[model samples]
Target: MPERTSYDAVIVGGGHNGLVAAAYLARAGRSVLVLERLDHTGGAAVSTRAFAGVDARLSRYSYLVSLLPPKIVRDLGLRFAVRKRTVSSYTPAVRAGRPTGLLVGGGEARTRESFAELTGSEREFAAWQGFYGTTRRLAERVFPTLTEPLPTRAALRAAVDDDATWHALFERPLGELVEETFTDDLVRGVVLTDALIGTFAAAHDPSLRQNRCFLYHVIGGGTGDWDVPLGGMGALTDALAEAARGAGAEIVTDCAVTGLATDGRAAEVTCARGTIGARRVLVNASPRELAHLLGEDPPPPAEGAQLKVNMLLTRLPRLRDSRVDPREAFAGTFHVAEGYGQLERSYQQAASGELPAAPPSEIYCHSLTDPSILGADLVRRGYQTLTLFGLHAPARLFTADNDATRERLLAATLAELDTHLAEPLADCLARDADGRPCIEAKSPLDLDAELGLPGGNIFHRELAFPYADPEDGQGGGAPARWGVATGHPNVLLCGAGAVRGGGVSGIPGHNAAMAVLEEG
Candidate 1:
């Protein structure tokens, strides 16, 4: 028989969120144990040498640091660092047989000029500023509430104090809001892209889940800026894991939890290795996964709609428009075939079980922003890494055949990219030791199989608004005000499936710790 142990709290899964919760709980003098199934931690927020025999350390899954709260970093004393991108985003366009594009975030003057050039109207630029200005105000009001107890919707609305901002973001369709605000097709697509990232829905979908997803993406850290991690994503999770260990948390990898049972006094967790009893249990797995462990029906399946591609490039590809330097354009988000109409058609195609001929995707060159991801030898060889995120490729399309669909999608995506490039993107290939080009594509099914992501949904499931629903009232045996509550009092969610729990942010973990401490 396996030995059984006891702890103040036990956290399942060793993802960044679980580590964060362990750090906070252990720091509070509670004996905590974190169990991870994988040999390694970090979960999706990991960096690896993806290409065999290549020295480039690519952020294999989750990249960038935007949603991580500064309070968590400061309180935990994490040593991670993130650098801001000099160039925000660049979208390729053509006018009069001349290479032209819209560039944002380099300079105020440059952004204004690019917007005017793209739209042929200064009014559109002004409207763009006005629209974001509203979002900025909304972010300011909402971001602070994330770490605190969930506020009632009425209370949050009062805090926002702007009916127009509330209606535009929460009540109205994001597609309608973007289309009404921005005139340029590219500009509109750029804004709408945030709503669709990792979410499988059209901007106009009445479910309003996309609105919640967009809110989290934009309100992250209150600036909505997706900054590059200095030493790749691993640095961030490593710091969190170290902090948890320093706080006296017992972290056990290669130990997978198989079942969880909770009584009024204590919770018991049975894992592959042994059974452990705790005063409380914190789950860092997705809601669906949690339900399976509890022998309950899972929530509605989540369907992810994105394709991830990682590549090591011999050199940056030349752009069709010679006026813009490749380095500057690739420094930030490089939009490819993401015009408004193109995005709509891509979604339509994918929804109909066909890969879009012209897929909407975005690429960013990490080395251009932070060369630390590449080894000294690779850097000297002028090699860089490109991360591509293709949108509108839903998981359902790949259900029949993942390999064939992935290849077709990748081929179509690269071909579409060639349209805007002076040379074929494949021409700038860097070969691995085996002489194969350093390129890898992961479809939604691939993500599901590799990352244990249900339906490959990165956020775990549809995002929930941070604020409490007013209609829920104080009835129906509602769990608690912390948003980490579950049907079982001792089993709290500390992962992306919790309310306000998406992204790389440790908000859910922090809140879960707070919940346990408060209950005691």
Candidate 2:
């Protein structure tokens, strides 16, 4: 139970963001209550032993950590950390019936060589240097603002201070930018994967939705490095929950918030257990769920356009490209059939409600970087974990038969991956004690039913630009100072749906707490 009829603030969810808010608010001495639907916290940022009788603990969903501000870590005194991968990404390819790939991040010189080797010229490599250099600069300018008050579009633009870079990143379609910058289809696809990770949009979408997704991916930590949390994703959330509790926040699990009512100044949260009141309400859920809680009609349902598959492998799979070692290639993001043409073709197919013949996906071997996630015995026996993310597999495709589509898509996606592998992934798969392959695939619908993600959209909905559009209002409205405000005076959004939110970042949670503190 909440242990109080009323509190200074009530959080509707106990995901990472919710825990972040609770930690911050409670540390500030505010009476805060966190209500979680799941029996545990962490939400999507959780690690579990998925396979029966398996000792390897895998980051089940939302595997990587980026955009989690250092300020939040220090402020909450969370006992957590992340390790960067030596190689950024490796995209395997087959050209002229010969195996090849582009490997990013082994120092600039090596990356340049890889690009040159793939494109047969230094032209693409030079362009790559310039493109990422600009994004690094933009990230430096834009990332710090996420934790602060909402900046007007002009203010952020002024801070960015380069019209050409600004126009390319914020104004035009990311797809167009990619086409103009890179000539190689594989290189272009590798660059655009960041933009379409969880987003379903074409490169030339006039809405510039892809641009927003691109910015989020690149601006993380001002360096855009997606680090692996040391103990898997759950380590961060576990630390967050502990920090929240240590600061005196009350967290009640298995207590679902059934309804909510607010009068702008005070609010009441009705849950599976009982109703509790608070002077302020902070919702760490999707906008759709928040609207329903407020008794308002939610906007059109958000849809997730990705497939997640987790596997415990007996050993790393050998690659078709003999130039690269399996340990080095698997340590970073491994791109599969994600060439520029392939991505567009897949998106077009999925948009028309059909699976692509060759699905584009990326794989990460977490145990390669941090073997602590696996049991000591498993580690000694050459075990590893593969966390795969298949792009452009939207929720709509599963509307008819979720399980069948998931299985079909998984099979197709893996088959595509095998095209660049010396061996089928199944051959490397470890079997559970029960003699079952330690593999599980999740579709958008499965995520929705299990995680309550609106249409399984990870960002909750379309991500808004970190900066507020000047036409929208002054500084995103006086009330929306931290991009966490709602129509109600006492209610705020502190979830992935918040402006400048999403990722494993606690920016929204920190902002929501700051908003409450400032109001008082």
Candidate 3:
């Protein structure tokens, strides 16, 4: 082992959150260094020249960037490095044996106005306004504080009470909130889809506060629907890396960490290159990622993490309608629930720890809207980039005899797309790393075992409490004792795998830094 080089802080994994933590800590006058497993920074939020001659977002994994505290970005001076663009989602009705754009310019205003126009109750619009206000306020109040350590008891209580969070946020599932607010199926559907983006919950599941929590996450730059990072999700990470360096944080990439050496007061990170020591060590990768680095000494988060199956496609999936809102049309986020029941069934199947026979696939295409990349040629080449996401299911489902479940899932997704699109996708389909088809998918269960995620569940801990668990009571709050942090005293935790569920939001990293600062 090389001589132990010491620093104020050492962050493992150059993912966005880790970078965020390092930037914040360095700004606070702490000497910091970051180690990344990949050759480049930006763990999941990376763009690579892996696909074509062009550098498109490689994974777009955990797709979309929302709920990231803008204050953090500004504070770190990350504005110049990152770019953002909004993508709209379109769901055309297969009416009259053809697909019809739901929003037709003037038609949108009419539809929006008419629904709320009648009965003196603009329920949908009013609900949307109120919900956005609530979430926005919540983000402002909660996100900024996450950058600091967990507040004192009085501070926590006062903050929660002052924000009226107890009344509005306590134990509420986002689905129920949406249903109560809107009478229309489509509006509720959009919100539900957003809530369940990277989660394992069903849209109608009662314990879906995490889904509600995800609202703040998906509400990235701008409004109305989710936003994708400009130039693909990779740009966001690049900006973070730049900001971290600007803050005097050193970054080393392609150096995978093998284990952690700690003496209770400080942490020594053992990577392929050598061992680097720091007063504090923050792990920005998923819990499993951390476990891989720490080996068996420091246990991974109790809650399991999921495996991600990423696909960089040559063409876009064909949607049923044309002339849809180009923004919504190009927007990659999709709510696959044909109706509420389908969503429930899918969740039920997932809970039984089995991949759903007809898994609901949330699809997105970032390359469609981003202008700098290849969109038209992808179409001309008979393809457009697409990603299909589903909940984490049982590992045995993949290994079971006959593999009936896997085949069913494979058939269901393509068959459902056929129901919505004009032509079959068989021709546009190409090869992938999975070899089964485009990309053979992996569930959270498989990810936990393979990637070293502890619980076979994503998020270091549950984001939405009240619904998260009654027995443990480790839900809600930015900082809690005995959770989300690295079990080791000096080692810290970050990433979506941190507490409060997963997404591209940098809260975990921000909070982890605050925790270290507070401890010091």
- Estimate the lDDT of model 1: 0.87
Greater-TM-score candidate between 2 and 3: 2
CA-lDDT, candidates in order: 0.87, 0.90, 0.58
lDDT of 3 by residue, 1-520 (tens): 5534889898887888899888888888899989887678876566544443333344444556655667776787776333343334444444446565333123446445533433235666667657767766555455544444444445644554544544434446666666677776655655565555445666545665445546445434424235556666677778888888998898988787888878767778888767777888887766556666667544424443222444445555456665443335545455454344565676687678666655665566656655444445554664455666654343445545324654566567657656766567665555543344454455544555433344444454456431123334334333344234555677767676554436666777777777766666
1-520 per-residue lDDT for model 2 (tens digits): 3256889999989999999999999999999999999999999999998988989889998998889999999998989999999999999988788999999988989998898888899999899889999999999999999999988789999999999989988889988789999999998999999999889988888898899999999988999999999989989999999999999999999999989998877889999767898999999988888888888988778899999999999999898999899999989999998888999999999999899889999999999999999999999999999999999999999999999999999999999988888999899999998999999999988888888788889999888898765443223333388888776778788999888888899999999998889877
Task: Return the TM-score for each candidate structure.
Answer: 0.97, 0.98, 0.76
Q: Write the per-residue lDDT of candidate 1 for residues 136-224, one digit (tens) a residue.
A: 88888888999888888888888889998889888988998998887778888888888888887778989998798899888878878
Give the candidate number with the greatest lDDT.
Answer: 2
Q: Clashing residue pairs, candidate 2?
A: none
Please list the residue runs of candidate 1 whose C-alpha ends up more than 4 Å from where it truly belongs after superposition.
1-4, 470-479
